[model samples]
Target: MKKILYAIIPILAFSIIFLNMFFGHLVFESETQEVINKYSVYVHLLSEWQSESKNIIFDVTNTWYKSDKIRNTNHVFDAESKEYNSNQLHEINGKSYVELKHEFSDCQEEWQPMLYRKAVDTVRHEIEYVQGQQLSTDPSVSVYPDTENENYDNSEQQSKIKNGFVQFFPICTSKDTTSYNFSVKTDNKDLGFDVYFVSSSDQRENFVNSKFDYYTESGCYGQNKQSYSGTCHDIKKDSGLLVIFPDDLKPWTTKVTVNLYENN
Candidate 1:
């Protein structure tokens, strides 16, 4: 009986190991196929949207390094996505502008401006300045209006808002990563400070009403920190992060650094 038990134990161990390997392989394949299917759907919708806007969302300077290096990224699942998501900053006519689109990649190349935060810019009173008008030289300061401020009204800088043709492109962050570094620099100082626009009923009415697919949000139009909730065509259901910043960047000949990290 002892001899039989010993032989049976070895056989059971081998069988268990074999089953795990087989099932694990199937699970991986299943997940991959699911992503591929979702990718197909995204390509269809985004491709159509991309056509409407013309192939060029915004012309940004592209940079290529000889050696592709990875750091603080071993655990990041969507490393490739982060790599493609990096922005291209360039100086044209002394104005700094980063193209507003996802960098071209095997997934898809398109631009849909997602980040929105209230910003303060000094316009020579003639050009038009909103009520919240004030000049600040600090990038670290928090200028975003508090949602709970009952006195909050976009009227501070009310004027004829410039409407640009934009669509829905989500700034996706992976579950494996911690946070994001959505910033750019010229001459090593943060864009004279970063300005942003957020999706408030009053702020992103243009975005929601634009040619974007139907957006269902949990928050009202003017609600602070809300997103137009939904997925592209068939991509996996996931959350989006908008890296909003100022558009009025003063251009300089500085070597800019655009990086994405697991945390800010």
Candidate 2:
């Protein structure tokens, strides 16, 4: 009987261990699924723009790879006010993310801008849209309406406060010419920046196919447009980099010159 009792103890302990392992796995799988679902839209965007130049900008702007602490912090739903936490959504990947905290003031408090320079640089590469454009105006501009419309009423103001951050995220990072310029090369009338073939007209059809085929091969996402001349043009290449903001984070354009240096 004593031998039987000893055997039963071991069996009970083994059963408990097995149950814990099974339940642990189930919990882990559930959380992973939640996190993945929350990022479904972003993942789709990433997959679509992975190869385009806009992808480079957006990827740099909204980076997911970061320190565990920042990534682990709950940036989604806000339980306190029973609403979404828009502040946490601004962490655009590790490449271009902003950190904003409310400032204290004796009379009236305000939200100061904490511009992330790295994020600005990420957008710089895509500023190749217009070449030789000067930033005559302030890079970041924000404008607000003087009075609210009757239709909006008080609810509109409250709604704006809650959903305001969503508007700011895109505004703060979109088309930012703070430290750089963005312009297309309009100076070159006849010959503009365009994709061409490495082969003659006879093989041009294959060349066109080859270009698009290469984009797909390189894991680029999006549709390729075929020009009247039968050449494929990547339209979505840098569209994502051309985001516009309302009044806040004002728009600015800069000019760049690629000129030859004359040595004395």
Best candidate, lDDT-wise? 1
The model with the greatest TM-score is 1
* Cα distance off (Å), candidate 1, residue 240: 4.4
Model 2 RMSD, rounded to 1 decimal: 24.4
TM-score list, all predictions: 0.23, 0.16
- Candidate 1, superposed: residue stretches over 4 Å from native: 1-103, 106-162, 165-169, 176-178, 184-206, 210-260
Alpha-carbon error at 153 in model 2, in Å?
44
| Candidate 2: stretches off by over 4 Å | 1-111, 114-132, 135-264
Score candidate 1 by TM-score against the native.
0.23
Query: What is the lDDT for 155 in model 2?
Result: 44
* lDDT: worst 10-residue window of model 1: 36-45
What would you estimate as the lDDT of candidate 2? 0.22
In candidate 2, position 131 carries an lDDT of 31
